[model samples]
Target chain A: MEIFGIPAQALYGQLALGLVNGAFYALLSLGLAIIFGLLNLINFAHGAQYMLGAYVAWMLLSYLGIGFWGALVVAPLVVAVLGMALERGLLRYLRDVDQIYGLLLTFGVALILEGLVAQSYGWSGMPYANPLPGSVDLGFMRMPMYRLVAIAISLVVCLAVWIAIERTKLGAYLRAASEDADMVQAFGVNIPRLIMLTYGFGVGLAGLAGVVAAPVYQVSPAMGSNLIIVVFAVVVIGGMGSIAGSVIAGFGLGLIEGLTKVFYPAASTTVIFFIMILILIFRPSGLFGSTR
Target chain B: MTADTAMLSVRDLHAWYGESHVLHGMTLHVGRGEVVTLLGRNGAGKSTTMRAIMGLMKKRSGSITYEERETITLPPHRIARMGIAYCPEHRGIFSRLDVQENLELPPVIGADPLTLDRVQAMFPRLVERRHSPGTKLSGGEQQMLAIARILRTGARFLLLDEPTEGLAPIIVKQLGEIIASLRTIGFTILLVEQNFRFASGFADRHYVVEHGRVVDEIAAGDLAAGSERIRAYLGV
Candidate 1:
């Protein structure tokens, strides 16, 4: 059997790779979408928070001799707490200011975090031991067991978060706050507290993604910066503030990128931007985003 | 304030948006099961007064009492949980959410949750368009959905700003009927309206506001005798 002028085995291999990449993309963009939706702020610091997750994990394992499994739980929580602190202390002050000020403040935070990590560890990447630590043999091809674990974990986390926001009673208030904060508050839901929780949750998602990606990619300060641009491209393709759109766009773009690498490796880098341009011309609100 | 008589009471309430003062030392009381209207021309601080009562606007200075308890410093959601719902001048409906979804929002946090059937019974149009997104509804339908959404929150006190604004005449008549029904159900309303005609039908008494202060107070039955006061303040 042949697919896209490639052998079936090769196609399947790339599909697996695509799925893994897509999982991370979906996770990162989901947090971005949530923060943007609820707070109406483009969190430029999201990628930094993601890196902080990796750093925390690395620190836990290296200095304290903790393992990957422990860091997975600890790192994201720590990052989320840090996010809450930032929201309560700094972001809260910018609430009445123009929304652009939020963007600027987060961007500054991103730079500071990136700079701190670089100063501490230098530009070299750190190695993290794979928690699952094995390979699984597929009939068509042999694959790393950890890759599948990462994929499964990311998918589960993504679905859990999506369900939490879309299906629960708390989600109702969240949706209302995103749409009309003042009205939601008037109804007696604490808008400020909602804002803080949303920020923390979004940051927590980024941290989780980082912990999962530490094994696949090099753990370094530059890790989040590299992914940040592509994630922004994914967000634009998905549409601003659309939860389902961000998730679908993240995975879809990753699959497209993987296919491009196999068929036309040179075009792989620019394919997401090409899709963004097409989306802007056709459905600017994104595949699932409402025009409003 | 009578025990269990007042739903929301504001005394010497002052609010500001940045450097501009919107409500200046305003005092108003909304009795339980009463429909009260604040009648004024545009920019009379009617909306600000409602927001202050709900604590939506930050940096508020003054006293707000709800259920005979001070609520001046409480957050908006806490105010909402206390059974006060605000429908803004723009009709703060979640446009992306469907009609049922919009109604589903309020009861999620409200003290006493009203069911879909209950709110739909109050505003039938909302039930008919329950599957439709809020933006798809007509102005009247959206208005009905907005009011129903608040009612679903079990809000004993309703702050509705210009519910009939920009609506068709037929819809305005429908709104009047709905307001009448709500009043019958023992709902206390704080209605902000520029159209005296629409307001006079439901409000027992009206407060005339001018340039951020209450300039005149008149009973709805005596609006004819108070026409000169209305003309001077409302310029209508």
Candidate 2:
């Protein structure tokens, strides 16, 4: 059978690949949304942090002889500590300043991190050994076991984060702090500490996405730089601080991009940006953003 | 007033928002278990006084002694932890959260915190709409949630700013009753109100503020005799 001039088998294959890419998009954008929502500062260094996650994982394996499973546990924690220090030492000072300064500062930090990694690893990508090495056939298409695992894990992580923020008392404090920090502080929550932890948690999510992406894609310093632009476009389409919106838009856009590749191969690269533009023109706040 | 006797005492408190000086030599005191009101017209620095006392203002000077401890330089959170709670003029309810979530959001500080059931029983209307988000609540309900949320913190001193602003007369009456009940429960209240009549009944003593300074004070018993002067001062 064929649909829209494409064979069903080929279509299914593309859809599976799209879902894999969507998993990454969803994870990365979710981090961006969380950081932006609470801290009210755009973290331009998120892509670098994602790259750092992959690098930390690579360092663990190459130097310390730690395997993928260990890297999965160790890498995000390392990145989270680094992120917390960055927030405490630098971002905390900029809290009272203009938002643009924060963007510029983070952009500078990203450039510094990327430049350092390039000096050490070089621009060329490094190969990562896939921990889950197998394929599962769903009749219409054969999906790689690792890719399936990535999709399932990403979904679980996203759902867990959603539940933590929506249903828990800590989540309520975070949501309230985002709305009015002073009021939350008046209620005796050390808001500055919360803000610091929030930034750390957000960047840690990016790091987690990095660890997941390392095996699927080549682990390179430039890997995050390549993926982050697309992720930003995804966030814009989803709505800036909307968590659910980020998850849905991330996966949906990935699938759409996958379908585009099958129909119009050349348009796949630009498809997300085009959709973002269209969404912005109609719904200025994006799909799920409340008017601020 | 001596700082030892008062629950909260501010002496020559001056504060600023950036370069624009707002609170100038504002002094006030609230005794333990007394409901005091700061009555003033718009731009009279009533709100600034409240913000300064809560340590929300960036630049502040002079002695803000709470429980005999100097708190003028303390951060808002630290000051709050010392058993002082502030409900801003805007009510400061988190519209994104449900009423129950909003009430439960604040960390319970100190001892003798009001339980959720106690708060709910105090405002049965809040219990009925606990699941509703703050934005969906009526003005009076939001105000009740705001006050109730702070009451959960076990903060003995409550700073209420214009709680009745923009509420209907009936709602204002309801809020007044809640405030009166809070007093009966022994909460020390420092209230700021534009509605002179609404505050006059509840407050034990009234301080008149003008240009960030306390210019006149009227005890509750003297309210009737000082009405003409207060009307002239408040222009109400």
Candidate 3:
């Protein structure tokens, strides 16, 4: 079996890996997009939050004897509370200030969080037990059941969030809040509470992605930084604050990277960045992004 | 009038935008169910006063009593939840929301919310464009929508900023009729407007704002007597 003059098994395996990577990318970037849209703050601390999710999940399993399934729910909740606290205590003060100040603040928070984790656990990563340990052979390729589950679940979650945001009244509020938050506040809806909850919800998506990643990758302090860099590239390609754009670009870019690995192995790592550059040069607002 | 009798009263309200101070000492009162107009030119701080009253202006010191309760310390949402709804000067219709969604966007704060049919009865164009994006409507329609949405919230006090600022003459006439109708139904409106002509048609009283302070107050009955002063202040 051959795909584009490449061995079918090898190509399918790469595509499966790409799908798994895309799942995480979509979730992470979607969170970033949501936070940026409403708050107008680029949350640089997102990677640290994602890492915290993995770390918290791992810690729960190790210390509290909580299993993967239990950690799945608990971990995101923990991250959300922490995110809410951060927004109330610090980010609230920077509302009227320049955007650079917000970036600096979140960036500083990221460094502090990442530093604390690195100190507690070595720069190297810890491992989590794969709850679904076996691979499922689907004729063409032997796919890890965990990866399959992760991909399937991420697709559903992303779809649900996109639909809710585009259709529901709460989602309408979220979108309008980003445009004219003061008006939303004037309507007697608490803007500060909404913003805090939104930040918590956005970062909690990262936490969700982290929980999904724990079995596939090592529980690492440095894990999120590497992945987030690629996710940022995905966001740039997708368009800022565009939910559907992020999900589609995440999967699309991941496949392109995987395809590059098969066709031209050398460019696999830089493929997404290259596409980001092209998108920036041509459609700067991104594929699905509105300029406003 | 005593503070107890007034629906809204602002005393010595001072607000600063960064270093440059905007509202110096904005003071005025609106009795319940009265359609009061704030007439001022650009940079006269009409919007700032509205923001200050709404508690949306962060850096401010003022005594704003609504329903005899001091609202100076309350935030925008809290003030809103208290049944004081603000419709911004830009006609804050959400581009992402359809006409119907925009109509339903404001959270209902009062016990008696207006039915969709009631709102549509006032602005029939809105019901026709209910499925279209709010921003897709004309400027007059957008203003009508902004004013329309707040009615659904069941807010007793409505702060409408320049509802006819850029609307056509017929639309402006229609908005005056709408304001007249709202007052007939017992809404206490504090309208911000530059068009003294449109406002004069329905407003029970007008407060002349200049350099962030209420320089003159005239009842609609005395509008004829105060016309010269108003024209000079308005620079019309």
Say which candidate scores most in TM-score: 2
TM-scores, in order shown?
Answer: 0.90, 0.98, 0.97
lDDT digits (tens) for residues A1-292 of candidate 2: 9998799888988999899999999999999999989888888999999999999999999999998889988999999999999999999999999999999999999999999999999989898899899999877678899999999989999999999999998888888888888888877789899998999899998888888999999999888889999999999999999999999999999999999999999999999999999999999888888778
- State residue A45's C-alpha deviation in candidate 3, in Å: 1.4
lDDT over C-alpha atoms for residue A230 of model 2: 97
Note the Cα lDDT for every prediction shown: 0.85, 0.90, 0.90
Q: Could you give the candidate ranking by DockQ, starting with the highest?
A: 3, 2, 1
TM-score result, candidate 3: 0.97
In candidate 3, which residue ranges exceed 4 Å CA deviation?
B1-4
- Which model is ahead, 1 or 2, in terms of lDDT? 2
Task: Return the top candidate by DockQ.
Answer: 3
**Which residue pairs in candidate 2 collide?**
none
The TM-score-based order of candidates, best leading, equals 2, 3, 1
Per-residue lDDT for A120-163 in model 3, tens only? 99889999999898889998789988999999878998999898
Minimum summed lDDT over a 10-residue window in model 1 chain B is located at B1-10
Runs of candidate 2 exceeding 4 Å displacement: none
Model 2, residue B199: C-alpha shift (Å): 1.3
lDDT of 2 at A58: 91
